[model samples]
Target: MPSLREDGAHLGSAQEPAARRGQLRLAALQEKVMLRFLIKKGTRMGLLILFAFMGFLHASIPDSGADDMEDISRFMENAGRIGRNIEIPENLHKAQGQKEAGKLLEYYQSEAFKRKYEAEIERLKGTVFKDTIDSYYGDSNGAEKDSVKGGTLPGNERIYLFISSSVPIGTLRNYARDLDRLGDPNVFMVLQGFVGGMKRVKPTMDFVRKIITEDADCDIQKNKCSAYKVKVKIDPLLFRKYGITRVPAAVYVPDVRIMDVTLSEGMEGNAKTGDHYVLHGDASLAYMLETLRRPSGRRSIDLLIEALKGGIYHEVNKR
Candidate 1:
């Protein structure tokens, strides 16, 4: 043996290199196994997250059929409410008859209407004898003469009938008949149309003339019946002043103090300087007659007289 110590040292060095190689191989094998285990765990977590997302999406979705039906039901309920709100009255004619009656009662009860009537009466009473004709009729000598002759009576007043050309011919005829039956000569009729256009005037005047002069037996050429004289004029200003918004309305202006004296001692006069009892709509002849007869602090008189008026009736056919 060359040297026992030297031999041992050489063997130890050789064994140390082999041990190092074995340690490197074992470390690489452990790294691969750890990587595989980490990848498998990550994949399982990703799959669980994906399933949870799918469940959330499913829960958020509404049932399309059920939602649509609910929306339809809401719409139908709203429509039914609208239909009930706009329901029509069954008795239209009956409603029409009561329309003015309610209004008249309200007006009678209104303090404002009473104050207005009283104020107007005071103003008019101050100038009762001043010959204050309405400025609507021109202040010419001829107009003044006409006003004195036909426009007014000594203690009587006029009935201003505000009518539109659009009113039915039958309705006009009925009004004329109702007025004729009243037959108060002092109550002059003033037919006023709201329209200002010249084109509309002739037709309206023509209609009024026809209705006034119409008789069963007489032709237009030979018709000699003396009908109630109606002063037909178009005055929008007058209509606005009187607060006449509707057609077929009658404004009955009573003499100052006459209405108050007749109805009650303390009752205010209803007639203003330009104000009148406004009859809003068409009423039956009997209804009008009875209503006129009521002591509403206004002149209650028949407008039509038996004596035939000579001037306009003769000239209507000529026109």
Candidate 2:
């Protein structure tokens, strides 16, 4: 009876504190939700920026010059490997029997390698020789023995042949076709092992000599093709300049130009301390063909410059 109203007022005041606590809890929960949302948005934004940068970087790369050089190098390496592995001659020894024979068969049957090899070799024999040989191979600027005749390249382009006398009949037949196709007057060939290997039959030598000397001009309609015997002695200076330390090396000289390394470039020479096996006619005629036909802007004298520089050095890639 003394405080019924007072009691009611105290109850109302108690309810106020409880209400305040509820409001505070609600505020904290809202803040947590907002923070989580912000973090998720930030993560998405960062990912978007990373992807944009990657896309921009992916759209820029060139197509010529250095890339072409790299392609050329790869091409040469592939050709050399293929030629070395296949095209077996009579002297090729497969003493390991079935194992070696199977390996040889695998290589021989690889159409991809064979096609590439054939194309490159044919190109060397055709284009490079056609472009340069007539100027230097003959006694007097590509003249025939009886007439003071000038020469022209077959196909009216560069024609060069990188061949070993020991090549198989199939390879020779393929080569013959290419020679037949040249229609220019100045085509020429560099006989890689012309002077030093085991001698061939007189008939074979006479036939090859005659083909290169007379038939090349008659069949191809040009006096440009010619052949020269690569000398036997491995000139140390020349070998050093070209970095050709391997034996049985051949260097095609169209206009006397070589395309390998040069002495001034600090290139090492082709000499082994105690072995003479590398000094004979076992020269890499195919590589020499590739070297002689190397692309150049200069004329005949450029060949001499290349030869002096040691054009045989880069014939094959490093083992």
Candidate 3:
């Protein structure tokens, strides 16, 4: 397995250049949008509009420096089918959902995703500062004492909420909380990349942190927010696996509870896995759940809904 390890300090240092490049890219995009608008209006000043755009584009998108995370692309595999259906390899499936989510989260958080940051995170766990930060930001959606109230993932259905930066912050926040409430590592909120680009991982990290912390407006570094309970992941592979072409969509994978694609050990030889049912829209989780349940008579769907209702959502779990 590729090591999901990296130096946390290097992650901090690369922010300057990446932000500069991001600003340039944003400016260029704005100029292009303005150019298209002005030309469509038929002001008979196409030449002048083009001239203005050229200046803005030159200033905005700039010829460019480079990104700190650019190195990751060299190591990163593009998202696409592996050209073969690989089945679950073994009991190694124990490393299933949570491992994938946590590893991807660390991949985005660490330097170049080559160095592991768990040691640092674990080291911080016992600090007074970390304690204060966790309490203020929220350590869980409704969990107490680092204890999640649930049994095994509880069903054969795997849920995924595919989203992007374009989705409204409030919508993302609600989804994060709901998934956290479900308390299954198998359930996830997957973003394709940061708003501007994936050349840097900080933006994705910061945005997801905000989404899970329930502090959309809080400037993460300057302000205190709720503890982040969920670990939003970026997995283009899963995105491709689900055939996601837009934001605010969801996928329901039924059956094969023990055989998620994220499992790495034994999927190399298998040919069949769960079927994928996708729902496209910007709706509440409950709405999506109901819509997905409709038209499908699979028992797994109901079992999935029951699992959602269990865990922290139980009568006492809710209280």
Candidate 4:
């Protein structure tokens, strides 16, 4: 038997891919509609005036002389027809637009369309928006994450390089290079809080990426976000503990002993830490380390100084 299908049979139903594309279009349109709705009130009157002016320009209407009482009477008689003329065409267009809209609504709500797009929304969310959600909320909002944790740190001797976004790029670059050279596990670049404000997390993360990478132009997507050799972290509690106000400041805290203690009555055990040697300046890590060195010299501080003694520094530490 010969085939009875029409020549346009393939066009009768859209393919799976076409349906998915249509769903995306529908989603895009919905987002636009929502944005319009938000600003609709301000746009309505302005658009009406704009529409009237554009209509006059499009018509190329000639300037007519002012009408007399008789001419006004004539126009008043014709005004009813003018209103009727406008009403009929508007109603007709509304009917036609509504009919077409109904058909589109039906297609979008249909089982086939729903089946194509329903799973896709979640799939897109999981793949594309996974990091967005993690980097922005709950445990990952930067406020709750790792106030004390900066990769792995030594249990005893520690060096905290207090820094902020306001610090000069040159100063930051110096710190970056020297910290990499030092390569000490106890060293960390500490920030008191977010750069701009804690209201959003992107700015802070962006600042961190900008300072850490050697390349000025770094994009995460292109994999240019090079990881720092040293750990950079935000620790507000640590800032409070050490009373850090200004930067660039380095605090050498050594002889910290970590131990577990039993519970006390309505009291938390204080952190077991060593004496802190503080130095403040806009100098390199090696210089700061040298300046913060003890008069008699402890073994841990001596080791840190030895690590940076060989590195070249532009500015000397001591006055």
RMSD of each: 22.6, 26.7, 38.1, 37.4
Model 1 has an lDDT value of: 0.50
Query: Which candidate has the top score in lDDT?
Result: 4
lDDT of 3 by residue, 245-270 (tens): 99899887665433333232112332
> Which segments of candidate 3 are over 4 A away from where they belong?
1-156, 217-219, 222-224, 257-272, 298-300, 303-319
Q: Pick the candidate with the highest TM-score.
A: 3
Model 4 lDDT tens row, 108-170: 436764455335434433543344322322142232123334323334566788899889987
Worst ten-residue run, lDDT, model 3? Answer: 1-10
Q: Stretches of candidate 2 above 4 Å error?
A: 1-150, 153-160, 190-201, 205-294, 298-319
Q: What are the lDDT scores of the predictions, listed in order?
A: 0.50, 0.40, 0.59, 0.60
Q: What is candidate 1's lDDT per residue for 1-319, written digit by digit as tens?
A: 2222421322233446787757755766677788899999999999999999999999999767988999999999999999889967788789777997687546545776556534543443244212221221223224423432443234445555667766776777665654454433333334443244332333543455555553634454443344433334444444765777777676665643334322311133433454456677776444543464464443234323212233235446679
Candidate 4 lDDT at 13 equals: 35
Q: What is candidate 1's TM-score against the reference?
A: 0.39
User: Residue 215 of candidate 2: its Cα lDDT?
Assistant: 33
Tell me the deviation in Å of residue 62 in model 2: 99
lDDT of 3 at 239: 74
Report the Cα lDDT for residue 117, model 4: 37
lDDT of 1 at 97: 76
